[model samples]
Target: MITTTMSASERFELSSYRIPGSDSCFYIPEFITEGEEAYLIRKVAPGFRPALGPSIYERLQIRDSPVQRWKQLANRRLQLWGGELTSNNVLVAQPMPSFVETYPDIINRLQQTGVFHGSPHGKPNHIIMSLVPSTDPSQTRADDSPGTKFVPCLLCVVDIFLTVEVCVCVRVRSMSQAKTVPPRSSSTPSMSNRQLQPHEDGPAYHPAVATISLNSHCVFHYYRYTLPESHGGRSIDPTPVLSLLLEPRSVVISTDSLYSNRLHSYVPPFQARLGMPDQRARRIHEIKEDRFTAGGAADFVSPIANWERVTDAATREVLANGGALTRGTRYSLTCRDVGKVAQLKSFVKR
Candidate 1:
């Protein structure tokens, strides 16, 4: 057997910061300064989107959402950046825009942290961001669902093996679209559940998954089990292995065994509760009143479910002082690289 020999740090890049209660998870708070965050939003907002056409822009304004047009997939809606990537997963071989390379210095620092050190391109060439609102149905938008199954599509190009459409970037929205807390009995879609799926970044791209959460906080749960019998894998209990508290402005990266060895998913209806153990609570409601209103919605609440803790001492230190994990809305940005462009082209043409 060819034993994979490498330092523990080499496997997960966990040395960049204190381990977050798990050997695989790393959390960095304030990864981007407020100013830089504002700048990024300004640059990517609808006003500055790459030109699809005046008609598309007009339609976008009328629709009141960035995803006015595009094919919606089972997981989440998609808007291809840097021109449509080839089906084989390689970009058109064009340089990413200057703005992409110009993301805040912290992003550059992320590169130095060695998170993407082993990727084919040594850096992410594509970006996928999602804006999901709270409140079901009313939460309906154009985003596609990734569905519940993992279908492996493989093709070989030259000497390179490729897998198509593995999720590279999966960002969850982070703010309360409601802006104010409604009656607890009131219903609203609050969490972007797909953002929390336990699926792997897959074999097509770098194993590392860089996720950033904005606006609110939510619990991300992970499970471990043998690949299903039909897939001919072993048997193991799919028990809760870990759960992460994704806070606004926080950055989390996971890879190596965490990427390939487990399944993860987020419990929906995210909220901010206080006065309870995060590991033993569930957030079954959304914050509908002003997030700061007294006695209304605290920044943190007891999530109603039993979550396996994955936070570190440092992360807990920072979270303890916040205004409860306020139940504002949220958005997640997952950056990844998927391989399989050459084969994708053939399918596209046919």
Candidate 2:
């Protein structure tokens, strides 16, 4: 998005990356170096997160091993730092690992962006590491489970022989935005890799959110919650509000209303056949993530709010050519600040 010369941390012209209709959002590309991304990936991975200090682990009685902190969800794998929130939306404070709490790779870099200037903690106290499962057809099962099982969402990929019917872009708008769900686990597609159900972040945290994408690229969307309606007996279609390409090592900073007021979801990374074509072509199998059945396609158009600000040439070309791009393994560090923290030690017994 915005590129400006400034300090030793980052070079960002934040205003240049704002989303048009949004109150405040900055889509900054190359926010971290490739080496930094790799290091973050290793640190954030659940089984590989840097181990807790021996003294602290011993005091807590947790094994000093690489504690399996990762929790696999219905659609994505997650590793939460700063402990999990309770049913009442209380975040039991647990000191974050060195990589996040004290290390300068992410939090330090984010501070330079100045997006968290007025946050409760003056910085993000909670971080959720998310990774969508790969969508390769080889993982498809006869039962049509996650990787390759088709669930109708905003887009569908149906192909017949050498031809395909896929809708790359669609017109989606936000009708309303107001809801307060518990900060509980969410169920989504990680493998046919199904798309996540459209939803908003919990409102318990500060209204600002900074998402850092790493390793691979992804298409993240912002939309209001509205169920499809059958109009004039026509097929039901989803309505999306805004779309953006999240390039690797890039960070999307959304503040005020966008992060706190609307729903967001990421498309599944894998492709699946929506139907079995003529029996003669049963042997043909080449996965195209965006190919869908046009017989039931939605109105398509590339309306990414920050398309012009996109700095990646390849992503620009893909958007330029019908606005369809393949999904890849994406690891996102979703950082936020939760003002209310209950000490976990209070609940632990001696």
Candidate 3:
């Protein structure tokens, strides 16, 4: 079954464009053709359904091709695929289902991205595609209370919690039902908007996150570290060091500094704009110019610091290109590895 799901032709073609100075991380623009993009959107539609209750809508969220639409949440909006992280930070073992894996070119190119080179599986074992609704007052609640209501919640109509274990690898068709409530915060609401904090991705899974931007274009914010002290009650600082212009159909792999050293989040702006020309801007929605980046060294791409410890030169070559690295409504396939499978089952059963 796994072999059948793995397509021979579906791999990243431009294997040369990788990020410089970084150990891991890769970027590929137009990783998927316009037609494939439409096909994926159509395939995910059926899986989108209410999870908890009727209040929330569960369905694949995407606008017409070239226009990215981000689904909103209190903190931010993101789609979850594969399976939820176990309480201990491990993902249950399972193959990335056919609907996702059928695109071999995209996956194969990513294999060379170097993000997954160190994992036990030697490639991304799971994938997730989701749309983050633009952040706004509607996304927030009345009292300004912080919790899942503030974050956003997906209603899981299905009570399917793979109790039997089986290294069950299932994709979250839509995050409409997943809990988006915010954890205890530290600092006062400093920024006009809230976002994902900059912190090392915990050992919950592997150390890489491969994101594909779709719909509109937006900048993903990254911070150096958590706040020195928890101000509002939360301890992390989700700020923007630099922003990645996530274009529709582009693929961005988050590993090394992009993944381990810093925190990443989407910045929701009232008016999104793209610095590039109208022809290029039209490829995505809410194109923004200078939303995050400044001038000089900032103009060129810089690899995440501390990433050298993780990957080799061959893998880094695939990330530097200018393909499908759009911003708005981006979906990420965070490939990771949990530990020994048989032992994991024993632990989960307990």
Candidate 4:
């Protein structure tokens, strides 16, 4: 198990993980132990079997008994440990699967770090386990659901055989770059760029999201949205403002403007270009290598956001040398505390 001796004061001193040039984003390497990561993979992998059936009963029979419930999507498979949210965006009151609720390393550490101290439930009550195939074109999109209000998300990524790359984009909100709206009441001040409107469906967007990576490393790119006279609307800036090298077992947290305004997506494996002038040729050349090695010359083609704070010397060396990472199947578990919860009927009798 992963152990830490840091006191509360030390744990809350998260300034080291903060990514510069953005409002409030943080990254930590190796948030979980190797053993814990392996166990999580085992627990979620069985649901990926092709034994899915058209009927619910038929699907349940694939495994005599399963701990979690599965929902297959067009390009990926999802296992929702807690009950699904209601039409009004409330999570039905239900216990999470034991495997999910009992993970003390991740749960406790997050609490100690004070990431979810202000959330409605004071902890994550919903877990969405996503199994993304290597060839899937659609990546996880930005979530603005009512369930995401006032909660910090903890996303854990586990890859099988080191073959997948996950990318995250953070949008930064600024006063000069944003359009403002007058407040409805005198007591309320004018809203700045990207601030949630009163009529907006969901609660205001939370600023923090924490992601832990396991089994493999990938690149994270950040972009700013731009409006052009030619297009008559806003579009993603072709070139990323910054890029970061996410080493295996690392964790990244984005807050404030980075979480509310930025758009994040994972770049497809073996794609030739990433639209940045300095990275275009480097990315193409790196993907061309027949066997993807975690460390090689192609990895350091761009400036990593928090290079000085990395604890692992080898990871630092790999990035300095520009290493390469191969693609593989990856599983991401995103935990959130839905703002609304209703005592609805239970799906499982337990």
Candidate 5:
């Protein structure tokens, strides 16, 4: 039986964009149009409003509805759709947001790609939304001082945990800030909002993973997977096996051994510039790329496996200049065919 809403031409074969020498990792640039990308951003961000009088409504809704709308974390904030799991790791069963399934219709298109062909339900029933903030709130920028103008780039994730059977991401943002300003600096040398930690989805779920970048461009790293500490696996080597440039509106899917055997992370604002002789950035995100770089000389483009695939001249030039691009807030939608789910009634009886 056929289960996809999109036609064949609209669906892409995953193998065509496979990374060289990799088993099942694929990258498709500009998977969604700019207009479509804008639409998705408006839905996830707190500042968006279709009407003027209700400006405060969305901010309040997000702030107040922590259990349903957004969950605050020590490192970041995220939303959960479908349902949260029980202590046993079984999902409670909730429907995904209508906007995610319709309008842009992300779920249906993903189904068409055959990315979830053999899962329990043959489609994702749960979605994990993640937000990784790129900037520290204490840092003051020229545009962010009292009464200054600051417009943030809504879809950039510098330290994002993007994983799932089918992962779709937007941007991770903390405070709203403009893209035009340089990295916010209070100290002569800046530290990252957080360290970049390389990891997988872990025991929470099992399956292939896919991601779509909604806004901004940055380098994503994949490393040889290390067994967990509990398993006495070797401690993670911060050096990357491969680095790929993730552009806005692009899609990357990892299946089979690639999803399970590799650890992935995005470059941070500071780490990308840490060792440059003239650069002042001291620390950014987690992990290291010291294997291929010498004193972190600006070779961002050369280290990435898909650097040549980048189409924009300005972006290409910036990567070559040893300067990291603006990693605005980024959001992600990770879909998985949860193993077990129970209705509210079923749970009540338990």
Candidate 6:
């Protein structure tokens, strides 16, 4: 049986499980119950069908398209709700799906935590659903799209099976002003115009990111951004500043410096060198490769930045094991409050 002794207010406090050596970040294990996680997985998963397609080849092809609504990416698929943002990072005024708006337990706790207190909208008005299939470590790619600039998002993961290593760029400013094109239809929108570029100043949204992990455990890595001397004479630190273990039903909150200063991405599956000398040597070898340098290292053995904060013994054991983890089908629902919103009527006339 699940049980907790802390008060609701205390549970959301930043001091409870904040990570060290970082401007602002926190972790909470078992933030949601098993029942809620199961419900969310059911909603995200494709439903079973009794009949097969006309022919064997057709059936195989049909199976490839797990969900019709997903916008296919090279490594993953995505679905957006409440319409895509405009060129100026503006969102059209529309109601989010009931499932998103009314995700009771999490929404209530987030509201209490004041994660979105200063945003233009009091709560999250946008949601991005990412469907990542099991991918080989060598085949996995980085998501450097402009959509990542939408900061202060709440990421909820369901059905995760492997450790996801994320690399983030902090303290670097983006100069690009790529436009955000809205989908053709709001409700059943297509991914035709989903490209996003970095913002000149920063994201038009707030600066807090909250993540909830469900059904799996993963390691979160944080890195500081640096520029090549040839570009502007500025140098970036290649080593990860912090790493945290995210267990099933856990929540992680990052804001301020952690949000604005760093770019975070999941680490691909690769075996780590157990000792520091061997690990550093391996990293140096990998860094020589253009792809590894451009993206970041996929494996490392440095101590997790927030290791002591994790209370789950199982997660600690996994981290202690220190090796390549098996991959699994994962679904992430990222919620954000778009600062700019226009009336639907005005959008239609345009």
Instruction: Highest TM-score: give the candidate number.
Output: 5
List residue ranges in candidate 3 displaced over 4 A: 1-16, 19-25, 47-80, 104-109, 134-194, 226-239, 269-332, 339-350
Relative to the true structure, how large is the alpha-carbon lDDT of every model?
0.45, 0.57, 0.43, 0.47, 0.57, 0.50
* lDDT for residue 197 in candidate 5, whole number 0-100: 55
Ranking by TM-score: 5, 2, 6, 4, 1, 3
User: Whose TM-score is higher: candidate 2's or candidate 4's?
Assistant: 2
> Clashes in candidate 3: how many?
70
Error of 5 at 330 (Å): 1.8
| Tens digit per residue, CA lDDT, model 4, 1-350 | 11333322246567755677665777666666667766665555533322221111112211221344456653445766556676667677666656555653455566566666787767666666655443222221222111211211123122323333231211321224433333245443211101111111133223455665544454666656767658587556534466665555566776566666665544323331222223333432333322122222223345566666556666566545654444344556656666777665544454
For candidate 6, write residues 101-202 as lDDT tens digits. 455335556656677788777666666666544333322221222332312112312222333222222212132442332333444312211212111125
lDDT of 1: 0.45
Give candidate 5's whole-model lDDT: 0.57
lDDT-best of 1 and 2: 2
Q: How many clashes (backbone atoms < 3 Å, residues ≥3 apart in a chain or on different chains) does model 5 have?
A: 18
Off-target runs (Cα >4 Å) in candidate 1 are 1-18, 47-76, 82-97, 105-107, 135-197, 226-239, 268-329, 339-350
TM-score of each: 0.54, 0.66, 0.52, 0.58, 0.67, 0.65
Model 6 lDDT-worst window of ten: 53-62
Question: Where is the poorest 10-residue window by lDDT in model 4?
Answer: 191-200
Give the runs in model 5 whose Cα sits over 4 Å from its true position. 1-9, 49-67, 134-192, 225-233, 273-302, 320-322
Candidate 1 lDDT over 160-208, as tens digits, reads 1232232211122222331222233323322333333345445656777
- Per-candidate clashes come to 61, 22, 70, 16, 18, 19
Q: CA lDDT of 89 in candidate 1?
A: 48
Alpha carbon lDDT of residue 242, candidate 5?
A: 66
Worst 10 residues of 1 by lDDT: 53-62
Cand. 3 Cα-lDDT: 0.43
* lDDT tens per residue, model 2, 8-112: 366565676677767677887777767667666655532322122111111111122134344667666676776778888778887666765444457767777
After the best TM-score superposition of candidate 1, give how far the Cα of residue 102 lies from its true spot, in angstroms.
1.3
- Whichever of 3 and 6 has more lDDT, that candidate is 6
